[model samples]
Target: MIQRRQGGFTLIEVLIALLVLAIGLLGMASLSMTSLQSNQGAYLRGQASMLAYDYVERMRGNSAQALLATSPYVISLTSGSTRNNPDCRTKTVGCSASELANQDIFDWWGNLQAAIPGSGVTVTKANTNEYQVVISWTESDAQQHSTGSQTQNFTLRVNL
Candidate 1:
């Protein structure tokens, strides 16, 4: 009788296959991690935008009151990783309620430390007899964050 050879993979072949699979899995895992982080960043931004809108709506609703109030409404603010004056207790001056309301709203949106409002713009041709509310926050590297403020504006139209 003739002896027949068994048709099967050798131990070395199986080990090599497993090693390749492991490497591929590692690569895939890293890619997934990066994608998750990007998604999280986008979610945070969306929340920030919603926060901005909330403040804008409040300003719109309280246009007459804000315009006639003795002081401005101070929203809250933060600069990415920078430390902030939460209450502005150190100084006699603080942001008005309407001025920084969007920022304060931003603070409530996520884990970010603060949401600061940048003094910029007015009610341009976009809306007549409306005071524009502008809010901004730093969200990147500290050095570049100042220039990289995430801003949103809304108009509070009042019949003056």
Candidate 2:
């Protein structure tokens, strides 16, 4: 008597194949998520860097105020609630150096908040004509598994 051979994969073979495919799919998904998070972190860092550079340039423009020890250029991370006089955005003819600095800080802080939530900026005087711009932001998702803290800081030092 001749026995007919099975023409398809066995149940065990099918199950093994499915398990392998599932693992591959899961790995792809995990890689995609990690790539997305990394991209977002990079984007945030770029924004922070640009903001710091922009502020530094503004300080350079107002070198007189920037060099002053009591100038707004030497500021801590505050809520930036000071209303700018003469509305620097519209009238740039007679705004004082301090007013321009205030306007710059206000606009920069606003942009920082809008671009990255929970972001803060601190400008510190390092020397007579040198300053450091420290930009801090929370990377809650990217650094969730890290040790210490989830906050990231970017510092840019400039000289007027």
| Clash number for each model | 16, 0
Candidate 1 deviant stretches above 4 angstroms: 65-76, 79-160
Lowest summed lDDT over 10 consecutive residues: which window, candidate 2? Answer: 77-86
Using all chains and alpha carbons, the TM-scores for the candidates as numbered come to 0.47, 0.85
Tens-place lDDT digits, model 2, residues 40-128: 88999999998888888888888888888787878777444344444776784767788878887777777888887777778888789
lDDT of each: 0.46, 0.80
- Model 2 scores a TM of 0.85
Give lDDT tens digits, candidate 1, residues 6-65: 979999999999999999999898677667655645655565555545555655555654
* Residue-level error in angstroms, candidate 2, position 13: 1.5
Highest-scoring model, TM-score? 2
